[model samples]
Target: MTADKIKAAALAHFANHGYSGASLSGIASDVGIKTPSIYAHFKNKDELFLAVTEEAIAREWEQATAYFKNRSSSFKEKLYGFLRSQKENYDEDERAKFWLRTSYFPPEHLHDQVMKDVYNLLDKMETLLLQEFKEAKEQEPQLNSLNIEHAAKAYIALLDGVFVELLYGGERRTEERLEASWYMYERALFS
Candidate 1:
């Protein structure tokens, strides 16, 4: 569909150029349309950017959390898998790049709008993590001593730290950080 093509082009441009540098004209050129055709799909660049951003955020969140739904994996496995998968996503996925870039460096005018979605996603992440931690503790005697709320918060913090490393530290450094953080997390949960 034309709309999908428009969005896809916008994603690449916005990812490479950032908000102010990306333009409707360029996006339209990529889509083989004139600048005004974009208006039919998106009211303005802001609307298009936010749409692409929110979509990327939602997709990234779903991908990052997919491990939690594994019926066969243990909770610890789920946590480790999440960290590994997120690292892969950051390294390979354009959407992840866009999501991370927009999240940290949103256009000045759209900061509030961007944060609103981001905060909602964070809240959802925390709640799901808390629930999973509680269930895992119930199932794993070793985890009974670990407070689920604290564990959830710590896990979220761990995720943030790992993401920061990947964003600035390259694949190798990110892998190093992931392993080290997992070790500490495992020790704390079991100790």
Candidate 2:
């Protein structure tokens, strides 16, 4: 229970402050414990940060799985739905902000570790996407000419571009950019 509380506090701090700026004392205070009490759950800030990162990534996967399973009728629907859904972040959701920041600029010391973890998550996501693309190509005669591997890679690249816009462009700008970019991408794919 204490460990959960510690991690919960740490998540919020890390989300807003990033790895380097997050403060153990701040997290401890938020958890209603002294700074040293955190040592009982985590050896140091690095461990706590990694724990938070793992939990955050797990939560994202859970959400994605649920969304993928329940939403959309066809493969194109699911793909486009996922792309569109990615554009909608809760205004108060710091986790999304934290994820964007960490993806682009992890702590210098933990960059490799963070990238490894993120890439692992992306691998799983892409594998799922590839299966969908394969099925879609098999079902849609028009799509048979498209290479599933290339299509999947291009889709992932588009998603990454969205993330980049979300990181640097504010909400209004991202919305405009996403609308225009997604239209162009769809035209290029189908035309």
Candidate 3:
């Protein structure tokens, strides 16, 4: 329970104030614990930050994967579900802000670490997507024209682009933009 509290506090801290700007003391204060007590759970701020990020990423992936798992529809339907899930995931208040901040203005020194995490997450996601794409091709040989890897990358990039827009635009506008992007993606991928 204490570890969960620490992680929750760290998420808010990192989301509100980037890595360099967030302080362990501030996180401890939010959790109603002394700064030193954090050490019992985390070796240092870096480890804590990574833990928070990992948890968030894992949650997001779990949600998406589950959405895909029970889906019993065409590949396009599954892909559309995935896209809608991406938009919804990025629409969350704290999570959306944290992702936007990190994507656009990550700490300079932690660039490698950030990239590593992103790549690792994507690699895991891609494995699942690759299997889906292979099944899609087997089901509908016409989809052979679309390169699965390229399509996956494009879909991911589209979500990232939509996420950036949502960060700048307010809620209503973001929804409109996401819908438009979704339609465009559907046409591009399915037709």
TM-score top scorer: 1
TM-score of each: 0.94, 0.91, 0.82
What TM-score quantifies how close candidate 3 is to the native fold? 0.82
Residue pairs that clash (backbone atoms under 3 angstroms), model 2: none
TM-score for model 1? 0.94
Q: Candidate 2, after superposition: displacement of residue 7 in Å?
A: 1.2
On lDDT, the leading prediction is 1
For 162-183, candidate 3 gives per-residue lDDT tens digits of 7767667867877787778778
Comparing 1 and 2 by lDDT, which wins?
1
lDDT of 1 by residue, 1-191 (tens): 99899999999888888999999999999999999999988999999999899789879677657767777987788888888887887777778878888888899999999988888888889998998988988899988787788889999999998989977898788888989999999888976
Candidates 2 and 3, the one with greater TM-score: 2
Order of all candidates by lDDT, from best down to worst? 1, 2, 3
What residue runs in model 2 are displaced by over 4 Å at the alpha carbon?
90-92
Please tell me which model should have the higher lDDT, number 1 or number 3: 1
User: Pairing residues by index, what is the TM-score of model 2?
Assistant: 0.91
